[model samples]
Target: MTDVVSYPKGDLRRMLSVLAALESMPEATLVKLVAKTGLDKKTVSNLIIQAGEQAGVQISKSGPIYKLENWGPVIKRSGAKMALTGALNAPIVLA
Candidate 1:
């Protein structure tokens, strides 16, 4: 079985960046997210889907545009933005 605990820190940061971008940008597309997060197209796409499914964020797409519908039950907008903005300032450890 794959080890969830061994997920890379870079990936975590990338995921957070993607979520942060969506939180800040109302009309974000895959391309915009990639540019904002410094991640590639495929990586952004995968992370966006992962964010929607695991992070409890509702993301809807119309044509080529993506929108953040609402902050779902699992994660809050301010909290995520805070973490991304270095308010937490602590290493993230997954156990």
Candidate 2:
């Protein structure tokens, strides 16, 4: 399933890195993405939307909470998911 959608090329690694972390947690928040992935809040927020759009799902934000429902469909179709897998294995500094 993750073999379908193509992830953004080049510098989207940071975005993919964020998504990779989110993938492990059942629920997430903008603050969590920022804290966990070391991405700024505004950057994580924007990147999440961009990542979701590229992955074929809308990453919904509820105040500080964020989530992607049925993310399996979106993720399985995303090349970013693969990159995310790799990103998860790589060392990432937490904010």
- Number of the top lDDT candidate: 1
TM-score, every prediction: 0.75, 0.57
By TM-score, how accurate is candidate 2? Answer: 0.57
lDDT of 1 by residue, 8-62 (tens): 5455666777777776787788878877766679888988888888878788999
Model 1 vs. true fold: TM: 0.75
lDDT of model 1, residue 8: 56
Candidate 1 segments whose C-alpha is farther than 4 A from its true place: 1-11, 91-95
Clash pairs, model 1 backbone: none
How does each model score on lDDT? Answer: 0.71, 0.61
Q: Write the per-residue lDDT of candidate 2 for residues 1-94, one digit (tens) a residue.
A: 2222233434666766666667656668766666676656777767777776776655666776666654545455267665555544643322
Error of 2 at 68 (Å): 2.2
lDDT of 2: 0.61
Residue pairs with backbone overlap in model 2: 1-76, 2-76, 5-77
The 10 consecutive residues of candidate 2 with the worst lDDT sum are 1-10
